[model samples]
Target chain A: MKNIPGDLKFLSSHEWARVESDGTITIGISDHAQDLLGDIVFVELPEVGQTLDAETDAAIVESVKAASDVYSPLSGEVMEVNSLLEDQPEIINTSPYEDGWFYKLTPSDLSELDNLLSPEDYSDVCED
Target chain B: MNKTPLYDAHIKLGAKMVNFSNWEMPISYSSLIEEHNAVRNAVGVFDVSHMSIFDFDGGDQVAFFEKIFANDVKKISKGNKAIYGALLNEKGGILDDLIIYNANDKFRLVSNCSTRNQNRQWFEKHAVEFGVKVIERSDMGILAIQGPEAMSKILAIKEIHAEANNLQSFGCMFDDDRLYAKTGYTGEDGLELIVPNMAINDLWDQALEVGCVPIGLGARDTLRLEAGLNLYGNDMTINNHPYESNLGWTIDMSDESRQFIGKDALLSIDQSKSQKIVGVILRDRGILRSGYEITHEQGKGEVLSGSFSPTLQSSIGLARVDQGYQENGKVFIRNKALNIEFVSPRFIRKVKMQP
Candidate 1:
């Protein structure tokens, strides 16, 4: 299993986001989330440019077993989506963090990142 | 939690374990969708040692089975076989679905894992008068190699005549020591092999050497759903009769001369209630899960089994809807609407079936 980068933030629901150098954020479900979901087959993301609040359903991750919503780590507007997931959704199972990146967003307020969990805090939250 | 003999093997492969039928089995290895699509596109093997197998020996075996079974197993020739026969209760409702293999010295019976003990109790209670010995072959291991290349992969390891008649659909035979049947719950071409428990690992190794991915229950459900096969407890139960479950053909009542258990209860009971089993292809952006309610403008029903069909690229499920609601066609998955299509129980596709 890949370790979450220290710089990224996590949600208790298992979504992770990295504040990119450009201030746009890279977002996806965490490795723990993908493992729990089994194999993802489809994905539904908020439209690009659609702003969302923290803790709101930003996207939907569908697996053969169940469908779970990916809550926004920080309030933002979806800027870009990784469309390759449309056909090969299983990439999320193999590499939930890197190649499996779901969407990119520009935070409405970068300060909202404080509400997210750091890698250490995220690991602690999942330990139970 | 219970564990099958393959438990250690699953753990060795880094499989994720989950509870199923009280037994902890691998829910996935690398990916459920990949494993599922592998079975659909090529070949995959599953350690189904969890299923129960029994051997019934005696001259009275056929007679006893005939009385308890709804299928006309007596009509099956020595080399032929019977599949999807209902072991019925007195009320004609399904006790369980079983397969009777016509063996040389005895008839081999395979029943559902969860219902095995209950079915055994029923069989024993009823078999005493018939003088048939119902021997539970619990020591044996059951493995299923399912997909397009399944049979050829197995045949290459050993020799199979593969005669058109012998390998015919639903036909089964014992090949030397192992019993290979062109039968499976998945709609794919495959064989369910029953061998001594000690030799399971070796067989699994051979199957793996031939490039069959080891699949788990997570993929198993998806593959079965893609094929549109009904799961036992989810699709039907003691409360739900066979007719309303869309399994009418499984009951062989054609020969009035044939007397099977539950015939009287079935014949006497009223099917006038508002229920019919149907299929739903989930159209919305969510996975339709089992036990989720299916709604229609006419009425509502419950999803018996639901999964994302790897082949169809959509969610598929079986449900029992009210007769009035079922007739109008469209079914609802959550708030999203899906078209309900009328269909027969899925058939075993040639490439995915083994005889």
Candidate 2:
């Protein structure tokens, strides 16, 4: 069974989101997503300052098996991007929730986090 | 989708299955890299029963093969020796690559399962003229036991033929009603066994009981790729000729009087225009993939097959570059062009010779 972090909210597509006190949301692929895509070789992060709508293609993660698009769970302007992934994509495979965060976004609306899946909901989604 | 004889076995082992050529096949038993290393460092078994095996029997068998195969059968007159070559169209395009085993009284030709039906039809179309009998052996199961310690492990297995220890590379022998050939796709010292369907389950159990891990097709590909082996549909197709696909060595141009299919077109084509297969290693970080562009100081080319080589722990690939290609090549991955080093297509060698 994959771990569904109780602290973070999730999208059905497997991206996890955590809203900071500053109202900025940090996003990354769920642990299940990283496990499915073993040995990630490249992570193409969204450029800082780019604006993205909810559920848009926000990043690209390529594993040895195949390439997958990381979707944004909420609409926001990219505040910070994970530049470390350019050389160390395997970090995502090893620590997908912590250092593997794709990008930080200052959400256009803070209320959008409530619309996303809760930990219990995301766990149920993964089960299916 | 079709299923192999070992489909249930793969599922029982928690293998991730995929649709390979309309057949339900296991792509990985564990992590792809772990399975890959198991074959490189130790022993592993692959269920390749999906491959098409055709048995030819008749006095005209040799004559039919000489006409059909690009390689000369005269080179393999003995029962054990096997000849690897291409079955070509009249225009010199590769219909399929196959290994023909000289079984003394008759011959057995093994080709890819992806082209099984087409190969059967082609053989039937030509067999009428030579009065050759072609029998497709779907009832046979093939297991490739490969790696550095593969031969020793097989020899230790009580159920396997003891005669397997004596078979040289490309040499085949029949013992206890099973054919064991000291041949493998991976650049390793091993044997590919063709066992009767009834004995397959027991043979698999015994191999595992003796410590042979079951490897899947995903590792089988990376292992072969790291060893500088070419994949059929990915590296070459009917559109590409043998000379451009690094299979020119398999063709026999000697014995000028002997005729093979596609010989005339091969002779008529300009050899100078052919692209040579070269190995590419990415200098920078990025995953190289098929259809990626390759630019060099002399010319341009395309990556036929590329992946993260677990043995080498880096990105590597086989690309077909235009003639006169030497050094200073770059592969375009995503939007960035990364510098690459070109090396001989063969990455690893078990010995000076295959045997």
Candidate 3:
């Protein structure tokens, strides 16, 4: 079983969303997602200031096995993208939650978090 | 999915299993990069038992192979040697690429698992006229011990150490039910062992005890790509011929009197008009994947096998492009056409490393 931090909200596609104290929502793939992708070689991050729709492709993660699209959990304007992942994409494999966050965005509607799956619900999804 | 004899062993080693050509095989144990480097710098063992192996025997065995195989098997029939060649259809299309080993009284042909059924049918269809018996050796398991230190590590095995010690490249030695061949898909000095399924687990354990790192299909792929070896279905298929698949060398047309399966159709093909497989290095970021389009000065083609090469630390691929395409081309990944430098299909050769 993979770790599903209780503090975060998740999409069925495996993206996790955590609302920061500053009101910006941080996004990254879940531990289960990285484990399934295996040995990430490249990461394509969304551009800062770009508007993204909920449940849309916001980034791409390429592993030796295959390439996968990382979707946005909620509609938002990209605030800051992780520039460090440009050189060290494997960080997502090692630390998917903290250091490997893909990007942060200012949500068009903060209430959208309620529509996302909770930690418990996401864990069940992973199990299936 | 079908499971190999080493399924339990792979599970015990915490391997990440995946479905490959209908077989449940390990994709990686720890990491693809780490396993790839292990085979490049040290020694690594791969459970390649998923590949199909067939044995040929009878009075007309040699004649049967000469009629169906593209390469001249007569060259290796004299000694304990192995020759790489392609099985072709009457239309000059490649059926499969395999290695044929001269195992004393009998010949052993190892081929890809994906084309097992079709290859068997093709072999059987042709064997009848030559009065040869084509037997599938499904009870045997194959292990590829590769890397710079592969030879020394395999020599640690006590059973056939002396016999395999002085084996030359493309050479093979058989001991009862076991066969050891100094050939591998990875462009590294290694030994490929064919052993009975009952004793495969013990051999795998011995390989690990001898300091050989356990590798999975993931690294096996990257290693072979780095070595410029072609994957059967990816690089060549029923729609392709040896002339276009960078395997023209495997075909021998010297003996005009010898007419193989595809000899007539291959002879009629305009060599200068055929698209050829070439190596492409991405000048931009991101990985290259199969089916990506390539636009050259002459025409467009597609990537056959593409991936990020761990050895080169850059993205590289084998692409079939127009016959007139030159040194540089552009590959369309997504909506953008990125610059790519074309070179010989082979990306790397065996690098002598310190033991």
Each model's TM-score?
0.85, 0.94, 0.98
By summed lDDT, the worst window of 10 consecutive residues in model 1 chain B runs over: B346-355
Across B89-149, the per-residue lDDT of candidate 3 in tens digits comes to 9999998999999866668999999999999998998899988889999999999999999
Cα-based lDDT at residue A25, candidate 1: 93
Ranking by TM-score: 3, 2, 1
Candidate 1, DockQ score (0 to 1)? 0.55
lDDT of 3 at B63: 88
Q: What tens digits encode model 1's per-residue C-alpha lDDT throughout B156-205?
A: 65433454124656767775656777788678887788888887888787
Q: Single out the weakest 10-residue window by summed lDDT for candidate 3 chain B.
A: B346-355
Report the C-alpha lDDT of model 3 over A23-118, residue by residue, as the tens digit: 999999999999999889999899999999999999999998789999999899999999999999999999999999999999998788889999
Writing each residue's lDDT as its tens digit, candidate 2 over A25-119 gives: 99999888887787687878888999999988998888877778899999989999989888788899889889988999999987888889998
Clashing pairs in 1: B182-B354, B182-B355, B188-B352, B188-B353, B189-B351, B189-B352, B189-B353, B190-B352, B274-B323
Q: What is the DockQ of candidate 2?
A: 0.58
True contacts kept of each: 0.75, 0.44, 0.88
For B73-100, candidate 2 gives per-residue lDDT tens digits of 8877657777788999999999998888
| Candidate achieving the largest lDDT | 3
- Stronger candidate by lDDT (2 vs 3): 3
